[model samples]
Structures are given as C-alpha cells and as structure tokens.
Target: MPFTGKSGKFNAAIRTVEIGTGDKAVKLGGENVLPFYTFDAPIENAPKIGVLITDMGLENEVAGIKDYYAGATTFAEIAKKAEEMPGADFVVLRFEGADPNGENRSVEDCVAIAKEVGDAITAPLVIEGCKNVEKDAELFSKVAEALQGKNVLILSAREENYKAVAAAAGLAYGQKVGAESAVDINLAKQLNVLIGQLGVDQANVVMNVGSAAAGYGFEYVVSTMDRVKAAALAQGDVQLQMPIMTPVADEAWNVKEAMASEADMPEWGSQEERGIDMEVETAAAVLASGSNAVILKHPTSVATISKLIKALV
Candidate 1:
C-alpha cells in the first residue's frame, strides 16, 4: 500500500534525528512511513519533545505554565530543571531579543547563555538567535564557536540569512544548523539548496516548517508538513528528508485558550486544564503532520503527549 497516495514502493517508516551537543542531545522517533501507520513499517521510537529555555522571566506568563517557571528566574535555572525532567529529550535555548523586554542582549550575552545551557544538559541543544538578520549572523557565529564540535542544532536561517548562518555553522561551530520557512514546499527546498551552495552538509541541517497553534494556522502547518514528507519519500527530495522541528509549545502558549485565566475567561474553563489541552492538542497535530521533533514548555503537557504517542505508535 502507498503511504499517502503518492504511489511509492517504500512504505513510510519513522526516521530519527539527534539534536544538540554533548550528553544532553536526544534522538527523536524514526518511522519509515507516515505517523501512526505502523502496518507499513513499525515505528521504532515515539516523536521526541524539547523545551525552550530563555534568559528572561515570563511575568504573568499564562496561568498554567506560570508555576512551572516560578523558580526558574534565569535560563540557567530553567535549563537545570529541564535537564532533570526525564521526559524531555532536548533543550532549545532561544535568544529572545526579538522581544523588546528581553534586554536587547548582545551577541556576547547570547554566546554566554548558549555555552552555559550547553554545558548544563545531557540532551542535544538548539541555539537560536534573535530575528535580526545581521545581528543573528554575528551572534550565531559566537554560539558556533563557543560550542564547536558539540553537534548542536543552530537555527533561524532564512532565505535572506541562510548564507551567513550556514557559513557560520560550517566554518565556526562545526555543528548542525536548522533552516526555517513559512509553510511552502518549494521555499523549503530552495533554502536547503542555498545552504548547500554555502557548502553546509545536508546531514547537518533540520527543516522547520514553522508550526502554528491548534486553533490558529495549524491546519496549514500540518498539511504543509504532510506534503513535505510525502515529497521527501516519494519524490526523493533530500531537503525534505531531514528531520522536522515544531515550536508547538511556544505557539500553544501564545493562544488565548492557554494564557487566559478562569477569572478572565470562565467560558474557557480552568486555566490549567485549558493549557494542557492546548499543548497536547498542538503536539498531537504536529505528530500527525510528520514532525520528527517538537519544542514544548510544560512538563505536564510533555508527559501527557508522550503517553498519547506511545499509545498511537
């Protein structure tokens, strides 16, 4: 039987990829076929999930997750807690200067935080720079240097920024790099081609399909990812074959269903229940979309989703 009506001979089997550096890096699930389609090929592992660690505190940060980070005043504390969580597969350290309140930290500060988080975990790490193209190039260069040969997943590369970020990963960090794009198959392929032009090996790249929340643009993200996977297996596009990353937790947290409290939105029900539901639903959507890995925040959500993946696979 075909995996998704593409009429390919090979059944979709789950594939795995390890992100980050040192002992902290983790391996996400690998299946030869599409997600939950075990009849074609048995999935050896379940989809892996990572949590995001930032340098600033999330004040009033959505009711459900507020308590989890109450003790995590800094990224260091957050990383320590995440590393302690058995269900967490990887650690994604994001430089959120894109958020004006995030201190507008310089590249030096970003490098320091990356190194600190890198040293603190056994799971693989994903180092992302602020959205500023030129600034990100400079910052990612420092991150690659500080964690050289560490096999981390450096990210936020785009059509405009791929050259600099790709070059930095190849020449400075000697680590894997992640490329991001809106939900477009051709754009994803084109970015990978540009990365190749810079001499970055295909093996060291992860593609980000740019996921959205469950109630938001999730359908678009899911359909795009499914198409990408279908093309990867049937059309033999190596760019689409690389592992996929989804910031499901981040996307879910931003939704009103997750951030709103019982007092503000009684119609939404309890904040904790709503938050977990949003996270689990978002994660479930990503799994269906063929995401190899996801970055999540809540420990409860991770646990619940892990169970769901186990049951489905």
Candidate 2:
C-alpha cells in the first residue's frame, strides 16, 4: 500500500482590510492559508503594492528614479505620476522632512503637503512620518484631521505613540493605522492590542514587522513574519490576524548593493539593474514570508513585483 502526505488545516484566516473608497478601493488579506499555499487553501485576495513618494521633491529623489519625477516638482505632480504609473495600486506619502533633526518642517507644512497629495490622487494613500516618535504623533494627528474621509492608512503607531496616532486616525478620522513592531511576533501582537484598547477596531489595523533588507538579516524578518501569520491562522490569534504591510523601498534601496555605482563596484554588473533586482528580490521575500501589501520606491521594481504577484497568484 502507498502512503500519502498529511495535509494540515488552519483554524483562522487573515482578516480583510479595505482602503480608499468607490472605484479606487482595494482589499488586502483574507487568505485562509499561508502565502501562496494554494494547494492547501484558497487565496481570497491577492497582495497589493503601493508606490512610495516623499515631500522631499524631485531634486532630492534617488538618481535611478529621477526620470519618473521628470517635470514633477510639487507633491501634487509627484502624486499624479505615482497614480499614473502602470503597476501602482496606491501611493505612500512619507513625511521624511518632518524629522526634527532633518528639515524640521512645521506641522502645518507637513499637513499642507499631505492634503495636496491626498487631493491629487484618487488612489488610497499611506501617510508615514519621519520616525521621530513625539513629532510623528503631532504630525500624524494633524494630517489625519486635514484629510478626513480620504481613508488613508496612517503608516505607523508604535508602542511609544500608538495612543495619539490611533486616536487621530481611528477615532477622529475613521481611517486605518499601521501598527509597527520591531521584528518580534509578541510585540507585534501587543501593539495591536494596545491600538485596539484605544477603541480602534481590529479590522482597521495592519502590521508592519520592521523589514530587514536582503543579506542584512532578511531571513530573520521573513521568519518573524511567517511566525506571526502562523500564530494568527494556526493558533487563532485575533490580534495577529490582520493583514501585514512592509515598507521595502527604504531598506532595499539604502543598502550598498543597491546604492553602489557600477564604477564603484564593476564586479556587481550594471548599477541600475542591480538596484532594481535588490528591490524586487527583497519584495518577493517579504510577500512570500507573509506581506499582504508593500510600499515600493522604484517604478521598475513596482512593475517587476506586480508581475511576480500576478504570476504567484
């Protein structure tokens, strides 16, 4: 007699989260099994990709992506370009200049730029701050108020500032919040719980598991995400069941493999192709590991990963 392999069943499924409204809306998560485990179960919704933009304007953008920003000086122009890109499902507006150590832009300036980009694009927006906990709370709150009813996903509410961010996004604006954790499943769950305690429904939360670039402990990040999904599905953990989002652009692009010029490292081959590959590969890793959506930087990576997701699904 021949023996066959045993198939396992998951007790829970990833919860679905919707962003935007009307014709521009998109749903993430809702998979009953692990990422791309089609043989075991059906995938209710395919992963989505959001292109990352910044308030830094075109001149400050990376050289590889400058062409996409051609003749687009303002936030509105950049948002338009991002919305028109072939594979961009949504746009992420990163307020990098708002860091108190950086440009230290005022809350008014950040809110103004957020409104401009939010108004220009019909696609859903993911508004992120510059990682300064105190400043980010204030900035996010003001931006959420400024763009009410846009259904934007506020990029982060950490353990340090979840209360203010969650209150502004979930309670005040009725928007979504990206609850972040530092590559730990327990912390990821805990942050979700804290956000929930603030009266934000679990459905309005998305996990950001602190992405690590390829070759720089990427496997650690991947495994952490995998474990988070396993706890959500196999263990029926409600706090971990929400969809996950990874901001891969900054991590992938900033690495030396992507930023080093061809002249600086001839053995690495073409600088352009290398950088694109770094982003595409990093995104693939995260998606396979358990990302329901990702925020990418380069247009080429967006198109490439879009193809990869279609093929996978």
Candidate 3:
C-alpha cells in the first residue's frame, strides 16, 4: 500500500515548529505533504481540537442556541463533557460577558472563571474577549494577570488593543498571545508585527486567520491561511510562521445548519448531529488549510473530529 503524492520524504523530517506550549501544548504545520497521504511526508502530530466554554450563559445573540447544552452550565460542566472526547488537547474559554454590549461582565468575573477552570484542567487554556475594545482591554488585562504563571493563550491583540493585551500578556510570565484579523493576509501580518514591536517574543505569539460559515465564504478563510503558511515556509516570513488559530465554534455555532431545529430540517439530521457535523466538517477543512489550533463547540463534535484526525495521523 504505497502512499499518495511525493512518496516517503518524511523518512525522519521535523522541519517546522507546529505545536505550542501552555498548560497544554499543540503542534501545527508539520506535515511534509497533504493530509492522510501516508506515502507522502509523514505527519508529525495529529491536528488538535479544543472545546469552547463561555464564561457566562449565552446572552443576546447566542441565547437561542442554549438548548444545545441542555442542563450543562459553567466551565466545570463543559470541561467534564469535553474530557469525555479523549482527544481534546485543550480548552478555550471566551469571556462573552466582557464584551460590554453583551452582559457587560466585569474583569473580575473573567479572572474568576479562568482561575476556577485553569486550576481544574491539565490541558492548556485559551482566553478570548468579547468584541468590545474598551472592555476587552480591561477584561483581558485582569485575566492575563490571573493566569500569570499559567501558560495560556491570550487572544486577540488587535490593531486597536494590541498595546494593552500585549503588555498584560507579556507580564504574565509564560503566557502566550494570539493575533486575529478578519480574513486579510496583510492585516494578519501587520497585527503580528505590532505585537512584536510590543516586546513580546515571536515564539509566544499565535496568529488567528478567523473562520466563516460553511457556504458564506469559507473558501476565503481557507485560502488566506494557506497563503500565510506558504509565505512562512517558502518565503521565510517570520510573522507568518506563528501558529494559526481558528475559532470554528464561534462561527459554526450560529449557522442555521447548527441551530436549526430537527423539525425544521429533518433531512439534515438531528440537531445534535447537525451541530457536530458542522464542527467536524469546518475543522477538518481548516486542518487541510494549514491552521494549527481550532477552538470548537459541542462535546460530541469534538469527539467526532478527533476520530477524523486520528485516521489522518
């Protein structure tokens, strides 16, 4: 059984740094060739999936999807459910309340949730803010300080708030930072440059290429991440070399395919299965597109995706 495309180059190759470090570390972009092509370059590490747990209950926007989790509440319950997957490498906790527009959650609340969940899990933790810039600055600052010695990824130092998030993340000792842009390659590069200017080490920075709904423009997201990785490996661009992050849960959780009632779309399958399918499909797509880390929702989805990843490895 010979493998496909460029047979056997990965006899013993470990060229790039695919994984990251924190409470839990992940490897990305180490495959010498396309996914599951055994005769090609051997894959160094399996693509990793992390589950998303919100700090507070879904408020205005996500309230409609709350039924998905049913009785589950709090990060602890989410963590317990995520552990059932067996392949989930880490957890990403988004402080939805801190968005200023959502629940207007305070910085203290964000810190408390991180402390509680970070202490309970051995997997690495990723902290994200609501879309609000001012509140994001305040909330991330506190969470960064709280996770201090704990190696966690502090997302989202944008052009608007890079200074604040970088300053705080840098002070947190082993804490790492993530830079996100909509789907622009140039913007993603610039954000990484800005974070570097802030005295944060490049090794600790992760780049977020962002994700889109299935039919709405997923190709654009996929192309941009591919381009970023190519520029890094072929052109040796330092900014593009940083690990890539994709929030599949954030995008997929709201799609009609995920939240539609089984009654409304029986042909699509059960709502639970539909939601999990959306996550697995989107995640596997990104894995092929060169994203290193993916933040996902639905415990069942994580489990399903993990199986897909194992088959690739």
> Tell me, what's the RMSD of every candidate?
3.5, 1.5, 4.0
Task: Enumerate residue pairs that collide in model 3.
Answer: 3-39, 18-27, 18-28, 19-26, 19-27, 19-28, 20-26, 24-124
Candidate 2, residues 226-263, lDDT tens digits: the string is 89988999899998999999999878878888778888
**Local distance difference test, each candidate:** 0.75, 0.89, 0.72
- For model 2, the local distance difference test gives 0.89
Candidates 2 and 3: which is better by lDDT?
2
Find the candidate with the highest lDDT and give its number: 2
Model 1: number of backbone collisions: 18
Give all TM-scores, in the order shown.
0.88, 0.96, 0.84
Off by over 4 Å in 2: 1-9
Best by TM-score: 2
The better-scoring model by TM-score among 1 and 3 is 1
Off by over 4 Å in 3: 1-24, 28-38, 57-74, 262-269
The 10-residue segment with the lowest total lDDT in model 3: 10-19
Candidate 3 lDDT, 1-313, residue by residue in tens? 9875535343322234323345356655555444455556566666677777787654432332355555666767655555444667877888876776667777887788878887777677788889787888777788888877667788788888888888887654557787878898999899888888878888777788688866769889888987886677556676777767788888876888878887888888777667667777888888778776678876566767778777767
